[model samples]
Each structure stands twice: as C-alpha cells, then as structure tokens.
Target: MARRGKTAAKSNPSRSDCSSTSNSLSRRPSSGDVKTDLLQALSAIAAQHVNAGSIPLAAALQADLKDVLRRWKQEHASDLQKNDKYVYPLEGRYDAGESSIENVARSSRDPRIDISLEVGNLSGADEAVVRALQSICNELGFAIFLASVERARKTLDEEVLDEAVRLVRVFLLDGGRVAEHVVLSPSEILGLQHLLPRKLIIYEWAAAISALEGQGQEEVPAELSAWIELQLLELFGQVPKLYVEDGPALATVLTPRRLKDIVSVMEKFAGTTPALISFLLAIHSKEMPISEETRQAAFKAVFATMLASFDITQDPKDVRMKANEQPYRPRSLDPPPKPPRIPCLDSDSLVQLTMHVIEDDTLRHELSLFTSQLGAQTTRINPLDFESLFLPFLHSLALKTTITEPHHEDLRTLFATTITAYHDRFVGPTPPIPPSEPDVADGSRRWVRPPVRCTCAANCAPLNAFLADARRHRIEFAVGRQRRAHLHQMLDATPRTECTHRTLRGGSPEALVVTKIDWDAVHKRNVRAAWEGRLKSFGGWMEKLVGAGVDLRAVLGLEEYERVVERREEEAPEEGAKDGRAVAAAAGELRKRKASEALVRSSRLQNAEGAGRDVRRRVAETVAVVDLTDD
Candidate 1:
C-alpha cells in the first residue's frame, strides 16, 4: 500500500488559543499591535530558546531577530535613527555580538547568542538556501517559527510560503527525528492549508485516514480523525475534474490499486461525492469514448474494488462443528464390476495401412474385410470415362453448332479443335475404343454419352452452347480448372458423418468454462451513452446561444457559412440550380391556383341569388372548401 501523508484538523482555532507568550513578550498582542509586537514575539522566542539550552536554535532565532530589527529601522527611518535611545546602530544589526540586550532585557549578561549570521545575510538570497533555513528553524521549534510565519505570511511570496507550509507538514505530521509525538495540533495543520499544495493536502488526508483505520477499534484522536474524514470528502470534489481533463494521463500516475483504495475510502466516509459519481457514470456509460485498454483497466479496477468488498470466507454456520462430528468407520467393499468395451473400428486408412505394411495379419484381414464391405455398399466411377465419353460428345456438339450456326463458325471451330486436340494428346483415344471388351448386345458396358448422360437432360443443347462459348474465354478456363479440382477433392474426401461409431462405448467427462459477460459490448454501451449525453447537453447550450441571437456562422468562424456554400456549389451546382428553379416554378403555379380558387369563390357568391338552386349548391360547396382550408 502506498503511504499518504496525514491531514491537519479542519477545526478553527479559538482566538484565546491562537497565541501564548513569555515574560519578555508578556502582553498578548492584538491585531492592531502590528510590527512592534511581532518583533517582540520573535525576541521572546529567541530568549526562550537560549534559556532552554538549545544553542543552535537560539542562534538561528538571533538571525530572525536581526531581520526584524533591520526592518524596524527602515520603517522608523530618521525618527528612530536620530533618537539614539530608540535606535540600535545599523552596524549592531549586522553584528549579533554587540546586540539587542543593550536596548532590551536579557536573562544573562552575555547570552551566548550564537546565531548563523550568514542566514540573516542570505534572507533575500537563493530560494534553496532560504528553504533550508526554514526547515532547520521548523525542526528547532515549530510553534515559534509557525507563529513568526503566520504573522509574516502577508509579506512572504508563494515560494517562501510554500516552503514554510511544507516544513510545517514535515515537522508536525512526520514529527522529525527528535520529536516523540506529533508536535503540531490538527488546527495548526489546517491553518497551513492556504500555503500547502492541494496535491500534497489530499494525499495527506488519505494517509491520515489510513492510519486512523489501521488502529482498528483502538481509541483515536477525534480532531485528527475528523480532519482526515473531512479532507477525504473534500478531495472527491476535484476527482471528476482531474479524470475528465486528463484521465489517461492521470491513470498513468495512479495504479488501479491506488484508485480502488481512494474509491473505497470515499465510500466509507462520504457515501459518494457527486463528482466521483459523475466520473463513474462517464466511465461506465459506454457513450464516453475512451481507449479499449483504458476502459478495460477502469473496469478491472472497479471489479477488483467491488470484489474486495465481498466477504467470501465460509460462514460460521456453514462450518462443520468438530465437537459434534461423527467418526469415520472402516468397511469392507465388494469387488468392482468391469465395464464392457466394444471395439471401435478406426476410420483412418493410414492406421490400417500401417498395420498391413508392418505385416500384422489380423489387422490386414480386418482392413480387407472393411474395404470389401465399403465397396459393396457404394457406387464407383472412373476418371477415364470423361475423356472417352464426355469430351468427344462436347467436341461433337461444338462442331455441329459451328456448321448449323455459321455466324460464329471461326470461334466455334477454334473451341472444338482446341478441346479435341487437347483430349487426343493428353486423354488418349475417344469413344468405341473401350477400356475393356464392350458387350455387343448391351451398351451399358460402354461409356454413356450425352442427352441421357447429361445431368441437364433436354437442356443439354444450352449446356453445350454455354460450354462452347466458355471454353474460348481465358477466365472461364481458369474457373473451370479450379471447379474441376474442387469437385475431385469433394468426391475423394471422407465425410465426417461416416466416422461416427454407434458400436463404441465408454466416455470421459470434460469441463468447459465460459464467461457470462460481454465486456466489449459493455464498454461500447458506456462510451455511446456518455457521448450521447454530452451531445444532448451541447445541443441544449447551442440552442440557448442561438436563441440569444448569436450567429452560429460568426461563432464558428467568420467564413464558415461562405465555405459551406462554396462546397455545396462545387459538389453539384447544376442540381442546386435545378432545385431552385423547380421551387420557383412550383410557387408561381401555386399562386395561380390560389387566384383561380378565389375567382371561383367570388363568382359563386355573385351568382348565388341570380342562379337560385345551382348557385346555392355551388356556394355550399365553396363553404365546404373554406371549412377544409380552415381545418
């Protein structure tokens, strides 16, 4: 687990507890006291350090003392300088040996005011040096330095103030090497919030909460615990903004485990911050477009966090009680019955062939028997039959078509001669040159020729015509070769259904694991919903802007509308012109039609009394027309 720093208490300090003083600084300074009282407070702190035998701290304090005296000199100017009693000479401010007890009371005649004069000289020097001085001062006594810093905060730049706040955290929260316990109160830590980095503050809150929780049921400081809880609640307010502006970048910095911890802490103290809820909605609502990896990681992080919340351990009731358990009893068992095994004939020809090749007599006999049975049940054909029968018939048809359809004589002759020559050269002799002695009485022994042999039957002429035309085309030849090879492969291949063995018995159990969730679908849905919501929100804002008289074109770009017009013209200028003309024509036609209707209405009214029944009927029809128009 990553360690987060503890937060300071959120409680406000009471006016009475804000300050305390020594005899040298006897009066509790009011807000109106300003510079003089602040200087006096510093002097008192220095005196106190010197009395406590912390020589190093006293020396560092002396440096601060001189800074106050010098500033006072500048502020007082000639009034103090001219009054010898009021002013310590300029040279005395630099030299601590000559110093401030001459004007003010001291516990010793020569208090060994061993101060690092260099620190006073380097007050306006390098920032690193200044910070080092602050850290040293913080270690000596946080109270005095914190008091001095609080008083001087207005005069300090952010750099110095940031350094001061960090020192306070280190000293107060970490308690340094010398401190036995936390040296600063939660209120003091909280007061430093103005100067502390927000990033540091949030982490400190997390760390403090973790520590409080680490103690389990033990008593904890109420103020500290409250501070941690408050910080956690407050931190959630920024989490959504952080994720939205730079979720991927932020994800790189934070581990899934760390995110889960943060989420867990938020849930424990503050049900859920609105910003965090919005962030989760954005992550889960597939409408928000994020990278697949990022979405998956976010999902995994949520899943892991939620899974961690479940107490998967066995329940107390579910656990068997050893005290009430029955003892195991040894018993004699009957001999196990053997399961009958039926022989499963292997379908692979290679296995059988290998057995025969190795001169296994039993396997060879079984293979011979299997082959004879298979041959008896199945019909077989020969490749040589196509060469002897089909090719000659197709060639003859092509030749016949060339003679009958003389328009394509050259092309048909070219196809028929090419096929005939190809068959004669590669496929040997044509029909009547039988593979074996053909029976004279029965032609069944000979190769079957087309008409009856063709699968297309009466449409064999069309088939021949197509084949004749296709044979001359280059693509057709390539296609035909491919299809022929495919057909051969299909015929030669063993069917899977034939491999099933109903005679076989016995089986082995198998386990299959499948997930119920479709993560891809979930991620897509989230992204889509988030995007749609965003679009709707944007659309509403856009509508408001347009309603307020903001021109979209001007807002988007000065020439946006012009560019759109130009693009439209470029794509289909003629189409646009035609549409415009059509609209104008339609408008003119509608106007003419409306004028005619008005004329008819006026004529009907004028003739209503003169034409009696016919005019009244026409007027009534006109009234019906008016009613329809009104509707």
Candidate 2:
C-alpha cells in the first residue's frame, strides 16, 4: 500500500513508480517522512531570515545548545586529545580589546597574575575608608622600605617583639585607627626620615598578624610581598607606590596617622623594655657592659610584669593568643652576662639616662619642628633661655622609671643646639609644701612661675641695661652698642692734648707756658730762616679738597651717614657759585658732614673705653677749633 520516495539509496538511483502505489497511502504522509519535508521548508525560511540579518531559534534549539556542543565535543574528543589545545572557547561575555575571534585557541597554561579581584564583603564598608588605606600603604612603601625591614629584624628578637606588639596594642586601644590612605604629617615627616623604619615595621607586623589571625590567606594578592616592600622604598622616589606583581586584594591598608601612633607606642617600649632598648643600643653598634645578675634581675622584672598582664583571659569570641602576643605586656627571658654592682637600679645613674632621650635623633627631629614654627623668634629662646625653659620638664622626665611619660630632654633639647655653663640652671616657682612637709589640704600658697629676670643685673650695671636693650634687637647689636657707649666715656673724659701720646703724641695745648727767654736768640739765629717774608695762619690746614669738594664718608667712614649726605647732594645739586640755592646746599652738606665726623671720632674711641662703661659714655662731646690769626 506504500509508495517509494525519490531519495536515492545509492548514487544516481531512479525515482519510485507512482502508478503501482495506492492513492490513500501516497497522499497521506508518515511522521518520519513529514519531518524531513518540514526541515527542508524551515531551512529555506531560515535562509531568507539570515539574508535579512535576523536569526530565528526555537526554544528546544536554544536549550539544547550545551547538548549540541556536547555532541560535537564527543565527536571531536579524539582530535582535541591529540592537539592538546582548546579547539574553541565558549563565547558571550569577554573583552574584545585584542582582535576578538570567538575563541583564543592557544593555551597559556602558566601561572597568572590576577589584577581583577572579587570585591566581596565590602558591601557595608565605607568605600572611602578602604580606598584611603590602600592609598597610604602605596605611598609609604617607597619612603619606609628599609625601615620596615629593619623593624622586622628587630622583632625577630622575642623580647623586642613582645614589647613592640604591646605598644601597638595600646595605641590601637587609645587613639589609633586612621580614616584612610594619607601621607605622614609635615611636622613629623619633614624633619627626619627615621620614622619610616618604625612605621614600616608596624605595618608589616600588622599585615603579618592579619595573615595569621585571619585578614585573609585566600590567595596571594597581585602584589607580591617582596615587590610591594621594594616598591615602597624604590619607586616614586621619596614617595610611596604599590607594586602588585601578584595579588588578588585591592589594598595595602596602612595610613600616616596610624603609623605615627604605632611608632609612638613602640618608642614607649624603647625606653623601658630591655629587648627594645638593647635592640636600639645594638643598632648603634655599641655596647653597654652590665653584670649578669643586674641584667637578669631587670629583665626578670620586666618578664614578671608581662606575665601578670598575660594572665588575664581573653573574650570567648577571640582566639587564644600566645604569651608574648598581647600588646599590653612585654617579656624578657634573658639576663645580662655579668651582674651589676646593685640589684636593679641606681637612681643617679637613671637620671643620666634622660640625656639619651634628649640626644635621640628622632626626638631631636620632633623638637626641630617647634623651632620651625617659632620662626625668626626662635632666637628669643636662646640656647640658655631654651635650656632654662625646658629644665623643669627634663628634671621631671629624669625622675620617671617608665617610658609611658614623655621625656623632657628629647623635647627641650630641640631648642638647645648647644648647651653651655650659661644653661646649667633654670628658675621656677617653688612649692609651698616641700617634700619634707606634710600635704596641705587647703591649697595655701600655690606655686606660680616668676617672671624671667635679667641675669646680667646680678653683678654688672651696664651689662644689665644692655640686656634690657638686647631684648629688642639682636644680642650682638646690643653688645656692640654698649661697647660704643663705653668707648665714648674713655675717649671724651681723658683729654688727648693734656696727656702724652707715648706713641704718636705731640700735644700740650691744655698747658699754658709762663715764659720763653730763648725766643730772642732763636729769632735772631733763625731771622734768615724765612729770608722771604711769608704769611701763615696761626693754625690752619685746608679742610676742603684741592679742586673739588671733600667727601664726608671718605673721611669719617660712616656709611649710613655718607648715604644720607650723598642723597641730599644728588637731590639738590649746586647751580652757580653765587646762587643762593647753592649756598644753602653747601651749608647743609657742611653741617651733615661735620655731624658724621663727630660720630666717627666717637666710634674710634671704643678701644680706649675697655671694660669702663660710665667713664666712656657719660662724657660730653668734643669740639675742634681752628686758629685763624696770622703770624
């Protein structure tokens, strides 16, 4: 009842005969046969759509995409195995930066650096905070590269590490968290780069602790630790930049203020903890010879105190930390090789320890900042005054046994570039209740700072007055002025004409000669001394120049006065010899020049004054009279 189809079983097969086939069977199509006819019709329709830049896909076709690929994979699995390559990559979402074929057939199976990282758990985070920390770490990386390593090395010693950790913890507890990435403040960072090492060390420590305590060990970031450290110092040249050779994280979270706080905390331990102190001492490549017993006792004391801090248990939510891990306590297990004369401390010797703080390069740097702020007025607090100002502070610091309190020497020494005998003492208010007296419940006689008085007044009068004057201008000027005043006294009161010059003297004008009997014989013998009659003034030498006018400055050597005269001369030049304007100008110039000459003469007398002040300055001015009589 069925008819044969035209589809050939073999090439060039003939068509089926329609005459022998039943009419009903031929007209009605079977399901399998109808599918072929349907497919051919759909293919033609699809071709039309394709030409029109449209694609039609059935639900089954779309859903079966993976399955279709699976089939293809199965068919090509042997070829794929032989080639050791991806025949093609599945495509939908990918960068087309490099000419994009659907797939990158080449296989680069080597390790990769993942710059793109998944930003998880930052949903609730303030983006600003994260960005800030990231930025800081990057900046600091350059400036503090060496310092970080040095700090880490110091931490290798358990005693130092414990102390250092404790300090960081305290700062964090008190006022430690930084808002975001930032550079160190100018006040701290401008003076010395020393803070870098300490900052770097703490950052590395924090980072290390985080890795251990769970900041994350998920994947090493695009930034390799070593590379980041190197970049921190080397790249950016005095600035900080992050080098992420391999990492998955977006940040290296350290900040300027945070680093400063951490450094301060560490510095606290630097004073008390043997570990920190010794490590610092060692950095100087010097030695402090201490007996075994003394060192042992001191270190043991530190250790015991540390243990007490450690005994307190942690919260249930926190991990069980190691003994030296706490930030509050510092431990010391080793004692000195030799025992000291006493057990633990000698107060006098301890007092001298304050000097080290004052001498510390880092502390000095901080102090330098104060001077910078004080500006030109820095001299107001001279070495002596500065030392005096900070004396009480230093004394108090000297009394402290712990590093918690700030050191006076470090702070005060900033102003004192050089201390001498002048600064050996400083005066302040004395308390009404001495240490020997009992405490006053009513607070009678409160102590107040007395006004600073001039020390020169204690012994010398002129020096005292000079000091008062010195408070206005430069001290050197004041001293010079006093010297000049003294010179005037020596020269003016001690008349030159009455005294013998012993050196260049030919003056007896103040003495009046009673008689001269040898005048007759002398005149007759010298009658021909002047054969030709000559006329001469009794005592006259031309004050004016041979041709032009005399220069006031050239004669007096008073530069300022010369300038004044020169300015006048230029502003009002002489016109004619008889002109009234010229006459007035000449007279004015003469008066000014005469005044300048007097000042010059007084100044020249400075050496004769010596240490005499009143004798030189109290005298009246000298007058020179020229004789106009003819002989």
Candidate 3:
C-alpha cells in the first residue's frame, strides 16, 4: 500500500497530499480524481513560472484552458457556491521567485490580471495559488513592455542610419509615395541626428536668400517657401536633416554643372510643389558664381511650380494660408470621385473637350488637372505662341459637336494664367492649325472631321445626346475661339506699313470667317445687333421646323447653312445701324408727307382758279356768302 501511495503521488505531481498510504490501501485512486489532481498541479506550476517572468506561459495557459476550468469547477463547486475565503497563503515552502502572499492577495482584486485568483477555482486552482500565479504574470507583462522598448530602440538606430540617404532621395525624388508603409518614430529619426541638419541648413539658407532677392521683384513668392517647408516636414517628419555646421556655409561649391544639375533635379521633382523651387531659387541666387541662365532657369522652375499649383476655385482662406506660410490642412482620405464616362473618346479627345466643357463643375475639376500639366509645360514658353501651342487643340475640340454647353468665360482665365502674351519666346515644330482642317490623313491635305455617329439607335441615346450637346457646344466654342483668335491677333499684331500707313496686321485669312456671326466682334455693337436679329429669326424658324417635323440636324447639307444665312439676312435691317434707323426713318417720312400735302394744296387752288366760271355756277351762293364774310 505504501508503495502504491508513492506511485500515485509520482503520477499526480499536482497534489500536495501524496502520503495517503492508508486511503490508497482502502481504495485504489480513481483515474478521474487523479486526472483532476494532475491538472491543478500543472496550473500551479505554470502560475509560478509566470510569476518568474515567463510570458510564454500565459499563452500556453490560455489554450485548452476552458476545459481545464470546467473540470476544476466540478471539483470546487461547494467552495465557489459559498463564495468563502477559500484562498489561503501557501506555507513557507513557496518559490523564492514568487510574489509575497500579501502582494498576490492584493492583486487578486483586479479582474483582468487577477483572472486566475478571481476565477481560478473554476480552473481547478486554489484561490491562493491563482492569486500568486497572477502576480507573477503581471511582472512578466512589465518585462515584455521593457523588452519591446529596448528592441525598438536598437532597430530604430540601425534603420535610420542605414536608410538616411535613401529617405532623403525618396523624399525629393518620389515624395508622392515616400511615406507609404514605412513609419519611422521621432526617436528613430533623432538617432541619425548627426546627418540631418546640413540639408536643413541648406534649405533655410536658400530660403533666406530667395526671400531677400525675391522680395523686390515679386520673383520668389511666399508659396515656394511654404511648399518647401511642407515637403520637408512631411518627408523627414522633423527639421535639422542630419546636422549642420552652423551659419551660411554652402553644402557644396555651386559650380555651373552642379547648379545645372540641381536646377534639373528641382524641375523634375518639384511638380506642383512651389516651396522646393523657391528653395532652389534661393540656392541659385546666393551662388553668385553660377551663370545668369542657371538663375533664370531656377526662377522659371519656381514660377512654374507656383502657377501649376494655382487653382482659382480653391477657397480664399486656403490661398491666404499658403501665401502666409501656414501648413496646409491634410487632404481628406475620401476616395476620389469616379471620372465621367464618355465613350469613343481618348485622353487627347478629353483634353480637347476640356477647352469647351466649361460649365460642368466636375468636368472643370478634371480640366484643371490637364491645364495644370499644360501650365507646367508653358513655364518658360511665351504667351504669344499660345496660338501655335494651344489653338490646334482648341480647334480640334471646337470641331467636336458633341460637347454643347456654352463656353464658360472662365476658360479664358485658364488660358491667360498659363500663357503670357507679353513675349514671343517659345518656338516649337507644330504651327497653328485652322479649325476647319483639324485632321490630316495619310500625310495628305488637311481634312475635316466627319459627323460623329452612335454605335446603334436602340442602345446609345446617351451617346447621341452627348454628340448633339457636343455639336452645340462646338457652336459656342467656335464663337469663343473666333473671339480669342481675334484677341490674339490684336495682342500679337505689330505696327505694319499698310498703304504706307502704320496698321495692326490682320491674322490668318481664316480668322476673317466666322460661322456664327457672334464670333466676329471687331464691330461688336453691329455684330451683336446682327446676332440678336439672327437669334430672333432662328427662334421663329426653329419653331416652324419643329412643327413641321423637319429633321434639321439629321443630315448635314448646304440647305441648313443657306437657310440659316438667309434667315439671318432677312432678319437683319437694311440699315447697318439698328437703334438709330427708326429715328432717321421717322424724320424722313414726316418731311415727305409735308411736301406732298403742300403740293396737293397748290394743285387744288390752281385748278379752282383756272375753272372759275364752273366753280361759280356750281356754288355761286356759297361763294358770295364766303366773300361777304371775308369783307
């Protein structure tokens, strides 16, 4: 029996009471009871290991723990039901690493960390044993927190040093995606503290020089500095890029080649970021050794970045903030709206449409992006060359009849902002193409675009509608284009000897022709009058046509053109002037009527005198009475 007792004790290591020799002799230990005892013993051991700073034990305890708890609850049903103080301190044989009984008891009050203490009886654990277990797990959690901090510090130090150059390169070269995925903590950046300040100093010095030089000419706007500052803050997350050697020391000697490279890099990378350009401008200006051309290029880049970023529709407050050098509010994370669908269209077609689809706010936003890109390209280009650079595009768009909203006047603003009419500097291979001949095929003569067609009648009403709209838009666009062309001619026209007198030269021959009379506005008042008259006639004609069910736009023919011109001519007054014609006609009619009346009276009197005998015979009495009254 004593030997059996020793075997049972060995088999159930969890049980504190192993020397039950008499009880073992009385009845063999039940396998179920032994299993329960073993589980409780294992829990007690795990609880001690946790107290000794073992974090892994917590995870192990958590697995299959539910079953263990059920079994434990079954054995301690009475103690749990009674809610008695069943937990008691263990004897003086407690592990030296374990928390003191008092500490364990105190920690048992917390429901989270004291999970075993509060509910251990359900897991077949004594309350005192669970409390002791929990106290040690708390220590392990603290050790984990400390270990994480140390690991992070070591990792950060290594990463910052290793990635410092790459970070700077990525920040300047690919700022759009530089911050994705990777996040470096402030401390991590600080670890490479020795390497950050020189770049920052360079940036600051550049900014200062630009501010000083740019102030007088408005050459360097505040936006450049703001942009640079914002970009720096975003990319590096802190200033002082890798340490500086105090004062205005140049990072490197600004040799012409280096200056050129820097300018190129800035131009390529700046995009719409004005601040970067400003910083480069500052550097260029301060580096007096560089050629004037280099400085000019830097200036152009800065100007380009600023103008490309400009959005007239932006809130004034935002503009003011940028102007004042404030950080921009972070962009919202809302997904961008899906682009509008226009079938049978490509990007070039859309770009063309952008010149005409002015009223649609959504379309306007998309167009802004295109124009922004165009603006960047036009940075050094002259506005006088806008005809060569932009007219061909406008002409292509104007011929597309499917985009019918009347041209919004704001499109002019876009043109004016991007291209400068002050100089004729930019020259490219492409010359301006007339709207009438927008396309060429097989390197042959210029060709007109054919009327657009929808794929099918039943399935493409939207397409047809868009085409119709586009056509209408093209009409207004045509008018606007003509106006702008005239304006451009006026702008670019030089004093020329015409008949030996100085005169502004007329534009291309095509400029004199306008399909819509409204587009020819050199004599604006007369043209407007003609347009108003034409519109009135058109309204009446259109009503008649619609009533007659005439398909006016169904087939393109000379009849439509003839009808429109004839209607307009019939509506036009014979007099070139409208308002003054009525007054002049009324005066002339009054004079003619007066002259006719006087002549009629003279003829009647002469006839009466010549036929005096007949008159006397017919009205002798009346005539005598009239003579007596007169006497």
Regarding TM-score, does 1 or 3 come out ahead? 1
Query: Tens-digit lDDT track for model 2 on 234-295?
Result: 31233121111101011122223223332233333332222222222322222223334443
Runs of candidate 2 exceeding 4 Å displacement? 1-159, 162-229, 234-282, 285-421, 424-631
Off by over 4 Å in 1: 1-197, 200-204, 212-217, 240-631
Candidate 1: lDDT over CA atoms? 0.30
Tens digit of lDDT per residue, candidate 3, span 4-80? 00000001111111111111112223245424433444444444443443323333333223233344345555454
lDDT of 1 by residue, 484-537 (tens): 344234323423211111111232221111111223334544554444343233
Ranking by TM-score: 1, 3, 2
Worst 10 residues of 2 by lDDT: 9-18
Q: Give the total clashing residue pairs for model 3.
A: 28
Give the top-scoring candidate (TM-score): 1
- Candidate lDDT scores, in order, read 0.30, 0.25, 0.31
Model 3 lowest lDDT segment of ten: 1-10
Error of 2 at 94 (Å): 34
lDDT for model 3, please. Answer: 0.31
Count of steric clashes across candidates, in order: 14, 32, 28
Cα deviation of 404 in candidate 3 (Å)? 48
